[model samples]
Target chain A: MAKKQLPYVIGCDGGGTGCRVVLADAQGQVLARASGGPANATSDFALTITSLSAALAEAAAQTGLSPQALRASVAHFGLAGVVSPAVAAQVAAALPFDHITVTSDREVAVTGALGGADGVLLAIGTGTIVAAQRAGQRRDAGGWGLQLSDQASGGWLGRALLEQVLLCHDGLHPHSDLTRATLADFGAPLDMVLFAAQAQPADYARFAPQVIAAAQAGDAVGRGLMQRGAAYLDLALKAVGFMPDEVLCLTGGIGPHYAAYLAAPAQAAITAARGSGLDGALWLALATARGLRGGAA
Target chain B: MAKKQLPYVIGCDGGGTGCRVVLADAQGQVLARASGGPANATSDFALTITSLSAALAEAAAQTGLSPQALRASVAHFGLAGVVSPAVAAQVAAALPFDHITVTSDREVAVTGALGGADGVLLAIGTGTIVAAQRAGQRRDAGGWGLQLSDQASGGWLGRALLEQVLLCHDGLHPHSDLTRATLADFGAPLDMVLFAAQAQPADYARFAPQVIAAAQAGDAVGRGLMQRGAAYLDLALKAVGFMPDEVLCLTGGIGPHYAAYLAAPAQAAITAARGSGLDGALWLALATARGLRGGAA
Candidate 1:
């Protein structure tokens, strides 16, 4: 008689930028991985499902398993824009898996950053996500977006820089090299105003590099903005209950840039991430598989 | 043989809320006045034109002048959302008048507040407009809008209050009565985030009264917000060249509320507006008529 085939598991990490999936055996050894287009659940639910399906299919193919066969596997996903339980349920229902779990991308990022250990994850890009995980319990602060929160985010930095330029134009604040360079980008102050009138967070975030560069060069306005951002980050770290001994992993496009500005204690606590978000999803999938077996027994 | 009719002039003050037109004689004596619907030029140019024309026609009718005869009048308008000369030109082209000058509503407000004399106008509502007029040379600071500026305006206060609530929610800040009350209005923190995602400046400004009341009741968060707003206002005043001796007229929905917050010197310098924006428009209309006669000679 043929030997019984081992059960499979799937892990998915989805974000605004792209969707990623990995396939593994019951023992949790990686079998295959694949990537697809953007999969922000809130922005485009149907597109997220599509992207996830395509990436999962590719990973299944890599493991020499049919899509139908893969549907019987355990799975877990950490996705951007899963703002509520209803969204998480919708995402879970859309995917074909015998057992699955869905959660906000922040959770998986923290898990991946700390490798399932108790620590903090500060993921700052066009947005900010400050999260802490202890003994599998997790909590997050900030990452509310550019409109209300995301205080120390790249988007916040860029928008604050533009605001400084306008203040200089109004003579309320003295101009620095950063502010002057920012003003030069516009035909006039009104042009900048018009641009800001319709600018989205990402559009504003495009200016973040200039701010970072100016701050590194000791531009007063840029340094002020960075200091402000750092202050907010410090608050967030404390709010999340970051302990001195716990790992502090700074990840994402703009996260590590803040190292120079972080408090000495936080800097001392920093550690390199062991895995990506995909690894966190895989870790969760394995846990789900174990739970299913335990229940069966 | 027939006595020459005194040249007619039309003064129109168009704002986001409504349009007001005053039919006047060459000497700036108001004959008839009428009001119409909203006339924010940038938001709806065609609608603004319609509103202005309707108000002007009503005023002309009250003054016993035919619409055609009224079209020959010298007109001056201070309209909301006239951000550029091109917008002003477009507004002027759409109106039926022989001689007309179109400018930002700020200019007319400053003129009316000080009765065309040298002074400062602090107009704070959903937006903030700080303008100084010295010997007819006028300068302004702030009033860019809620996104880029409007630091001390109602919209800013309300938005800042919401931000404080979120900060409290994240455990990054202590919640005072104001923040707690604001949070209670939402189903949950997520609901507040959803609301902010789609909120306009007016929606945020609706919360200003709560902040003001809480501040009056000695809420720490509210008091801090008010103090921050007052500081920005002081900076704006300095930016616009507001002199200690100059008459500082507080106008608009939220302007006088800051009297308690302003510096003693600024409070001492405060004066009631001499006339409304319509009066300032009428003054400009008279100036236009005089210029027309002088050019003809």
Candidate 2:
């Protein structure tokens, strides 16, 4: 039997904190977007499916589509904690969509940031990673996940700021605005026990905004933490063989905040991402639907 | 009901990692010493009691004391993660003892470091805190636990080393012996995720020895981390009103390693702790048994 081209597609960005689903027509025009609860496939596969289903329902509702129609749409999932191929297959099998592709959030992050073009996308939110596309060949330098590395990410910055606060806790270095503010935020040194005792990557990342704010306020320690994080990002770009003059997109929550601290040459190379990870996922799904795998726009 | 001196006393130092019990006489003479499993009271009060009991039994076995005899002995516990009086009371009440007193691990840390004399102790192991004894008045500056603050501790140093390794992951900073050693230990960045994802304070602290060893070998990054930690220790000491020529004992696992990094004046003031936390517990137990509270030797 011959198949008719699906009229729409769905792009999913599933993370530990929450999930985002985007619905678009075959022409890559957005139809609807929605959000749902967490979908960390590694820790809870059932929850991932449930979250995806909920998010899909919301998107379909927004687009005035029926459940069966939406189910027929091609879908692409860029999820956190989806590191292994086996897990990806399991997720794909569990998903209700007729045609679907699942990959690391990093992949869609790069695709979305670069809009299927050959360039680099450095995602530095709760976690960190650098992904680049050149002549349709893509490679990643970091983002092994939060356990191993996420160098210049928000979580990394929060962790680094915490270390700085503890380092200054001794007054071995002069107390700076950063330390004072951090201590004030977390309260007494003793109060920090509960925070660190139960802190996840997102918990640590929660302090990134504060660190950024402090840096902007001329806090020496804050600036140091910011610059250090940026340096790591810079290193990640270089590690992936990022050449000057090539387009580079700094993606994620804290990615853009680091621009000012990057080297002049690299800074000059930086540019806005052509689209969001949703756009990238949609493009991936559309391309895959046509049997054009890893074919960049 | 005239007061009678107890025949024996038990001094306990219980932390997240392990429990130490020392059995002593009313005269503060050490009789038996033993170790047992972890006993973080805040995490699991029942487990704490079990571990403490196990440690106490070992100490009793060493002295050939029966269970009933040991239960008759007054027990003074210095336990980690017992931040509130309520928790302490709960722990004390759960113990199978005729009489019991519960205080923080920091208290015995100071007592052990100062040997009951008026002085200050900076404990930097898996956590950080400073306790000062002056004019029979005891004051503390830190040791809030790993969450709140533990500046210059093994955990802090380990965390710093991890940051350095991540930073040097980009080779932004030159590869030093410290980074080399850390990478070799963790294998690759990918392996670090499992470590960070599952790491407790002790897990991060495990790298402290490697960092120290690297520093001794003249690794620039290692020395930087060590020196930074020492500075915090100095700050902690100063924060607690450390006076020149006053006996300041540096305690804990990484306590001694930071000595060289301390400033000249502070280093000059640093002295060897007269006893261990067990000894301090014994001293405190004896003092309390005699109705002398917080009184220096």
Candidate 3:
């Protein structure tokens, strides 16, 4: 005897910071949304599994569905650090769902920004990644990772701000509120050096918001950091082949804020995402389920 | 009585990288010169003892004397990261020498650069620091640490080179031998990200020589990094109250190479170091010896 399969679909957008999930019915009607801890399968498989499970349970709980019933449903995942196909397959296979699909977080971001249409996206946060899609052909630039690229991201911006504080302390640059705050926070340059000696990109990213706040308050150093970040973002967009006619979307934690500082033309072309990344994941999950049911998406 | 105190003087210049020692006769004539591994007394007391022991043994061996003979001599210890008086006393007590005088590595560098006279020094290396001695009043600028200052240091220049490499990879800057080498060394930006996630300042400083070499070969990126480093050095010098006709001695592992890039007047004022930091430590040791003997120096 065949047990009844639930008509549930789940979409996940995961990264080093955390994960977001959306649950929907077979008809693509959104039913619930939830959040979870970070999920980077490549870095820690067990942690990613635990986080995804909690997120899934939360989503399932919203709809009064048991975990067993949800396991029979279809699922789609968009995650960071899924750079290799092997890892992608491994992550997909690790999931509890009967049917599964997995792709890069950038794909979900682009899909979310353009609402399944053709366009480009400049997403900024703890990191930056540029993605473009034209007529079903997609290309990505930047997001080479925080060290070699993602120059305009929150992590990069924070590092630059700290450097500015150091430069100011050295008298290579003038002091500002931003630099003062940084010095106060670190107590001294040695403290900052100690912090940098061990700080990860996520740790550095914590300072980005303070830099932005100081910039908005008219601190010269802070404004300079933002301007520099904007310029890098522009360069990244051009490098990724952003076109004039295509609708461009700036998405992510710091994306909308950064858009305000972009060049006038780029500013004019900027548009908000049509749907969230979780929404895009939900759409993909629905499309996958339709394929399984032998129906048009 | 007093072990007929050996008529000897030992001068030590110790830092995080390596240690230099000089053994001299009662007349202050050098009898030997030797080097040893890094000796940071406060952090690793045992390792410091071992390194200083080997260095002293080598110095004594050059004079055909035993280590026990050298132990009765007056010793001057100028070391890096020896910031507190308590630590200084502890290090002095730990050494085998009967009379011990401990100072900072910077003190030796300044005294060495100035030859015990009144002048200013611009020292550049893995880090940058400027010291000025005028009428017995000394002032220091820069070298707050790599995080807060050290604007034009080898570490700073290396970081600039890496950023330039990333910029080139993003097409925001042009390609050059420097960028190509960087990419080849790291395998890609992703690899670089992983490296940065764990790299220390010394790790970054390792690339500075390569950058300088490429610059000497007329690579634009290389030239730019040197020029920027020089400008920062200039700022550091000015901040420390460098004066005209002050016999501005540029000293350190990479100092002289940077002098060629300084402004004309500043370059003209530059002079060769009268002696090495080891010589300064020796001079101080001689003073200590005279004081112990109840004689005027």
Candidate with the larger lDDT of 2 and 3: 3
Query: When only chain A is evaluated, what TM-score does every model earn?
Result: 0.83, 0.89, 0.91
Per-candidate DockQ values are: 0.64, 0.34, 0.36
Q: Give per-residue CA lDDT, model 3, range A59-178, as digits (tens).
A: 888899887768877888998767667878988887887788888788777787787688888878766768888888877777755644667788788788887877677665789977
Tens digits of per-residue lDDT, candidate 2, A1-297, equal 556545577888876567888888876788898999777676467888898888887887887888788778878999877877988999999877788899988777888888757888877777776887998898776665554466777767887787667656754456788788788887876566567766766778889998999999988988988888887777777777888979988877888898899988788999999877767788788777556322422
Q: List the residue pairs that clash in candidate 3.
A: none
- Per-residue lDDT tens digits for candidate 1, residues A12-70, read 88875677898999999988999997676875689889999889878877778886778
- TM-score ranking from best to worst? 2, 1, 3
Q: Is candidate 1 or candidate 3 better by lDDT?
A: 1
Model 2 lDDT at residue A231: 77
Q: Give me the runs in candidate 2 sitting further than 4 Å from their true place.
A: A1-8, A39-50, A63-72, A137-148, A158-192, A217-224, A241-243, A292-297, B1-7, B43-46, B64-66, B166-187, B219-221, B292-297
Which whole-number lDDT from 0 to 100 does residue A207 have in model 2?
Answer: 90
Predicted structure with the largest TM-score when compared to the true one: 2
Docking class of 2: acceptable
Off by more than 4 A, model 3: A1-10, A15-17, A22-104, A281-297, B2-4, B7-104, B185-187, B281-297
Q: Please give, for residues B133-207, the per-residue lDDT of candidate 1 as tens digits.
A: 888788889888778888988889999999999999999999998899899999588888888878766678889
Across B49-88, the per-residue lDDT of candidate 2 in tens digits comes to: 8898888777877889887877777778998888889888
Q: Tell me the whole-model lDDT of each prediction, alpha carbons only.
A: 0.85, 0.78, 0.78
Candidate 1 reaches a DockQ of 0.64
Restricted to chain B, the TM-score per model reads 0.85, 0.90, 0.88
